[model samples]
Target: MSTPSPSSSEDVRRTRILSSKLYFDVPPSKVPLIYSSAYNIAFLGMEKLHPFDSSKWGRICQFLVSAGILDKRCIVEPEEASREDLLVVHSEKYLDSLKSSMTVAKIVEVPPVAMLPNCIIQRKVLDPFRKQVGGSVLASKLAKERGWAINVGGGFHHCSAEKGSGFCAFADISLSIHFAFVRLNISRVMIIDLDAHQGNGHELDFAKDRRVYILDMFNSEVYPLDFNARRHIHQKVELLSGTTTDVYLKKLDEALEVAGRMFNPELIVYNAGTDVLDGDPLGCLRISPDGIIKRDEKVFTFARSKGVPILMLTSGGYMKSSARVIADSIINLSTKCLIEMQGEQNTS
Candidate 1:
């Protein structure tokens, strides 16, 4: 898109329309059962993709498809990621290493991780992130052009710039934010990662950036074993396990309020992880489904009220089939909220 010059008071009267397309792009084979051989990679191991199961996401999308919740909207069919897109955020060496199931026989003895062909790895890591990043881009684009839009697949917040961790191969929020910031020249992006895990990748990548504000709510002792966080320019909250939904929501409210006071966000990335649900073997915190909806509703409402466009990304949820349930909740809330935004604009 051609970057247009910012406007003054006269331009305020000519607000552009936002988009209303929610993207759902997951490859058929990519969404496999967590324990299947398809999920095994050389170094990534047999762990379920983060906390949310891909099978569940696949199932939920299918559910949405069957229910006709997703019909006649702008849809992005899954496509293999380009080397350029990967290069935008990952190193060439790492990208090459990811391509070859085995690393160059040199320095350290590489672990016996499942050796996924670069094509496979690219699909596993890049496919999900691309949908998320591209979805956000499209959503943000549509909102600017129409009024509002959404991407059904996103919230891959655990991903960093260089490597994959917590099942995240790449940083969805980072790439999307950078794409918008550089291409569209929109500054002040606010990312709210309400997953049960820390937005460590965001912290790792943009903790010091003056333009990005990352607010993460995660239990310190979850996966990756690196819970020690030094509050770099970003807001970090460590929620202890056994914390009730009320306490968690209250803290989230505080953080959202604080973020509002500090940054007038042009765009928001919301990582709605469902691992917080009870019985989620991976997540430490316990947030019921209803609680999650309530939390999501409040956050979406707050962002809309502030006139900040939001992009939803499904980050982590490892409760096997329950991944679908969690993802469905996020999609439902986002779809409803976006439709409401459309309504408000029409009324005005």
Candidate 2:
């Protein structure tokens, strides 16, 4: 078979992105916070085995609603990304590999998942992930239209085009950027990854692509110590395991300043992972709950100052407390006037 030229491949990708239903227009009455109950993963007590809070997405929304920070009726539900959407970034071989129960179990790090049939695994785990991928993809469009958006799920940054790792089954971050490139007519994107672990997936995918600038602030001693991928980061801030809240925030401020000087992007994709909390075993950092809130405020403030649209994705947080912290941060953002959770009033 003859290899497709780069231009041909670009044409194919554009076609897939244009034909995708995942980028449907959300109503003005709805807030740009993208979420769906289907974003949560739980079935047969299998979720208990993983260190992650599988139902974190739903719990975050529940907390927001209980606190009256968000109106549940106005939340936008994204369509699940179809196989065609997945093909926009994923290789046919990689998508096919997901069919095996073993491959999925290894990627998600759930040993028992290998024993269950692929069909069950698909419904319970991968389906939820795909829905989050849809949310991530749609968030960029919403952010462009509304100045800001938050996908309560997504940030599967460990999965690249041809691989999945560290509980990331799909490359939602890369998929969203690709969708934005074609559908939104956006050429410049900046990925601000504040996850505890490095976002090696998107880093590798955009390694040679100058259109995307990455500012990755992650613990240097964590799960995905990908030195090769580290080279791709336009601005890399590596922190020690026991780095405190003050130190983390200081580094973030400096990084954002430098990033602002380096790249002028039209959109910012913020991977706001709560795993940086002091108690997180994986993150190992000593950032407090209030610190996470402050960190989010700083990023949003930066985006606002630059007059750039920003989209947030809840990435990797293994603790049960992550949901509460995330909800609190969103509330803080609203209090700071960085985001408006209340839907736009229809004056018509």
Candidate 3:
């Protein structure tokens, strides 16, 4: 079979996205947050090998419910991104590469996954990732309708069109922005990535795209040290290891101010990775839980003040305490009126 040209493939991808069911109508009764039980990954003790709390996605929702902040019925569930949906950003060759267990194992940083049957890996690992991708895409739609939205499980910032690593298996951030561009009629996007790790995946994907502005603040001493990706970042805040919360927040204040002066985005994609929390072995920063809460608040406040719609993705942070921290931050957002919960909207 003759290989299809890049333009033809691009046309095919645009068609697939136009016909996708990922952007379904959410009820007024539900909040603009997206998640699904399938977003979690666990199989035969395999998830334990990595520092990732594979179940963190589900646990965050659980805490939100138990804390009386969110009702279970008000949470939005997202469908899995079908193969056609993934092809929008990932090349067919890269999708074919994922059929290999070794490729998936390396991407997830879990060696045991390579020994398992590909079927098991697909069902237990990749399925959850696809669901998260769907949620990320849907979040853009929600953000355009509501003032802000959040995807409880996405931010695969280490995965590009042709590569996956650092526990990221798909380029969900890229997919989200593409969906926004094509579906939501959005032109400008600003990515505020505070994941404690450089978001090389989206940076490489949008390297030459002028419509997207990237503000990446990450630990300088960590993984996926891609200097090539750094060039793509519009505003780069490289924090060193053991950096404290006070310094981190001050840098963010300046970065946000500078970014505002640089680009006025119609949409803001916030990669709120809690790995910067102190004691996260991989993140290597010393940001405290309150600092994380404040960090999220600052970002949301900035977006709100600018009258820009924002969507948050819980990208990287897999510690046992990560769930509670995330839930608490969301609650803080609601508490501070940065975001409106279903109950709050109804009460108002």
Candidate 4:
């Protein structure tokens, strides 16, 4: 078979995006907060081996609902991403590699997963990830229509189209941008990744693609340490391990200002990971709870000021308290009027 041209590849991706059920029209009564019970990964207590709180997605929603910040009925449930949707970004060989239990075990960094059958691993682990991927893709459409959206379970930033690592098994961020480019008629997209670790996956995927701009503020001392990926970042802010909240926020302010001047984007993808919290083992930064809230508020304020639609993904927070912190930050965003949780009353 002849190798497809770049134009032909683009056409295939566009066709896949158009035919995807992941971008179904959400009802007016539903909020742009996309999530589903399927987004949570828990089975046989295997999730406990990793430091990550596998049930954090569900906990975040529970906190919002109990606090009356969100109505369960108003939350938009996204479909699980089908194989065709995965093909939009992932190669056939890469997708095929996922069928190996050992391949998945390495990606998620849980050794015991290698012992499980591929079928069990697929249902227990990958299904939830694919659901979150779908949510991330749907969030773009909702954000474009509603001015902002949040997917409670996505932000798999360490996974690229051909590889998965750092507990990230899929490139939801890259997939979301591609879907928006084709389905929403968006030409320019900005990714604001403040996850305390380098967003190497999306950076590598969009390295030469001028349509996408990445502004990544991460702990330089942390994991992945992808020097080549760091070269692709349009705006990079590297911080140390013990950096306090004040210094972090100041750097963020300066970075956002520079990003604003450098690129004008039609859409913004905010990877708001709570892993930057003071005690997160993986993130290694010392941003306080209040600081996380302020950071989110600042990003939303920036997007609002620029009149750009924003979609947020809860990325890589590992602590047990991450869920509560994420919930509180979201509540703070609503209090600041950056995002209106009242779906039925929101006119803009």
lDDT of 3 by residue, 1-348 (tens): 998998887788789889999999888989987889999898999899999999999999999999998888888999899998998999889999999999999999999789999999999999999999999999999999998999999999999999999999999999999999999989999999999999999999999999999999999899989999999999999999999999999999999999999999999999999999999989999999999999999999999999999999999895899999999999999999999877334545
Worst 10 residues of 4 by lDDT: 339-348
Give the alpha carbon lDDT tens digit for every residue of 164-269 in model 1.
Answer: 5555655666766766665456888887888787777777778667888877778767754454433653777777777778888899889888988888888887
TM-score preference between candidates 1 and 4, better one: 4
- Residue 101, candidate 2: C-alpha displacement in angstroms: 0.3
lDDT per prediction? 0.58, 0.95, 0.94, 0.95
* Colliding pairs, model 3: none
Candidate 3 residue 3 Cα shift, in angstroms, is 7.1
Root-mean-square deviation per candidate = 9.1, 0.8, 1.8, 1.7
Instruction: Please give the distance, in angstroms, between residue 232's alpha carbon in candidate 1 and its true position after superposition.
Output: 2.4
- Specify the highest-TM-score model's number: 2
What TM-score would each prediction reach against the true structure? Answer: 0.73, 0.99, 0.97, 0.98
Q: Which lDDT tens digits does candidate 2 get at residues 1-348? A: 999999999999999999999988888889999999999898799889889999999999999999998889999999999999999999999999999999999999989999999999999999999999999999999999999999999999999999999999999999999999998899999999999999999999999999999999999998899999999998999999999999999999999999999999999999999999988978999999999999999999999999999999999998999999999999999999999988878897
The residue-by-residue lDDT of candidate 4 on 112-199, one tens digit each, is: 9999999999999999999999999999999999999999989999999999999999899999999999889999999999998999
- lDDT of candidate model 1 versus the reference: 0.58
